[model samples]
Target: MSEKVIAIILAGGKSSRMGQDKAMLRVDGAHLLLRVYQVAVACADNVYVVTPWQERYEDLLPVGCQFIREARYEGDDVKQVETHGPLIGFAQALAEVNVDPEWVLLLACDLPNLEVEVLQGWIEGLENSRAEAIAVLAKHEKGWEPLCGFYRKSCLLGLNKYISEGGRSFQQWLDQNTVDILPDCSTDMFFNCNTPEDLRRRLL
Candidate 1:
């Protein structure tokens, strides 16, 4: 059998830009986190939510969705090294899974248009390209979007090392890996909700 694909939802951000937890934001009738969780469930064998506060995510996450807390900013060597950022979250997740998955589809909770079909397309694209991973490529003006991408769990060690060195930029870590970009066409699947206007146009 092939290695199973896992889905990791990054929900630990301070949500400073949105003024509230983006995962708590509603699009259609479901919370954004739950929506993304549903999509992840559709595409992978397992799903996990990466957050610092399990209580904050209680209402936003569905029953049975596993939660992995990033290592706190202040703690022992293990803790300090694990709280850098998204990489920290991924590291904690890998510890829980105990095996290298074929891929771990990482997604942000702020995008309202991340649906099952789109994610399925991403998985297929990754397989077809024979690339190490597949990420949605934002336009020139938009820059690169890695929040919505697929990664191999075997890379967790290198990612953890980057975090230990105080690297917080996800794009920078991705640069050292084989990443294939899935260009955004007419529709922007990664149109994240950052401002009131963006939320209004996409969520409300």
Candidate 2:
């Protein structure tokens, strides 16, 4: 039996460092978000983009990609909705997923170098993943690369527990769970275009 897979792409970041919406950045004639979405579509059974502003990208994405409106933190102030980080955004999106996919591929919109073949290879190995593991992710010196990785759909229970208890850091939540290390791949594949200089380097 093949594992059913669904992909969730995170585009809810403020992009403070990039000085603009990273999803809308153009590379090789396609928006970065569209590029990542295309890769996800090729590798997974379904693809969903999670963000607060769905209308912003509805025109950019193709017909198959679905959108989940990320919730904003409401406060007493009528004009102030706190910007929760990616972990919360991911948790919310995962909770809203209608299908029971065995694995969920989580990606950031700014990863312009993502390749379908490499991701497919990774997906192929998920069936062999340790039963104790809640996620399969690449580990670098900094820590597990949570944004670009595979998480078990069943992990949402623990994820919600952590979030309800006020945990907001991906690294923190992942640290408390069992995770399998992804086989070594090219480091460039994980590169994030978060800054203007990073975008320039990506183009070059």
Candidate 3:
């Protein structure tokens, strides 16, 4: 693909719902993050994992995959740094890796079945849509799938603006933007493991 694209795998969630780090959860004998990383490398020229605990996951990624450290409030005798939410991590990572790419493929690590075919198909769909949408997000009967989608560099300003205005909900932020919704709502690849039960039912 001549159109420059960067893939970003979000792995900085607190995983409080899972009671464990969902990114490290094994699926078919490999970490969920690693599986997502593999698919990303196949779809883009560059790939990055956005997280706060870079050291914890450095060895899990392939040789060339880079890390975009999530911006955290430095702590000493003061405030400390940690994962806040997907939007905050996304904004920080986008600033670091979005080097004038036509599109940015954003992914979440908990998606275990993300194949290269699925990813490439979305990129192709976005290209054919012929719309100047800032984002091309997945949609089903439920709602917009914001995490597993392609975003244009032009979206940076809007994302930052949303955060600046005290917006924390990604879904809420997306509702205000002009986004093309992809109708290939197959749960086979888009399903995410938010809890242990979800992990077993969807990924195991």
The TM-score leader among the candidates is 2
lDDT of 3 at 17: 93
Compute the lDDT for candidate 1: 0.72
Scored by lDDT, the top model is 2
RMSD of 1: 4.3
Query: What is candidate 3's lDDT per residue for 1-204, written digit by digit as tens?
Result: 345578988998878899889999998899999989988889988888999888889898877669987876656743245557998888888888746667999999999878787677777766665456888887776788888888887788999999999998888888898888776667578878998899888643
Error of 3 at 34 (Å): 0.5
The lDDT for every candidate, in the order shown, is 0.72, 0.90, 0.82
Candidate 1 has its poorest 10 consecutive residues by lDDT at 133-142
User: Which lDDT tens digits does candidate 2 get at residues 1-204?
Assistant: 556689999998888899888999999999999999999999898889999889889999987569999978778994455778899889989989979677999999999889887888888888999998999999988898998999998899999999999999899999999999988755578999999999999899
User: Quick one: RMSD of model 3?
Assistant: 2.4
When sorted by TM-score, best at the front, the candidate numbers are 2, 3, 1
Comparing 1 and 2 on lDDT, the stronger one: 2
Estimate the lDDT of model 3: 0.82
lDDT of 1 by residue, 120-168 (tens): 7667665554455534343344555767777776777787787788887
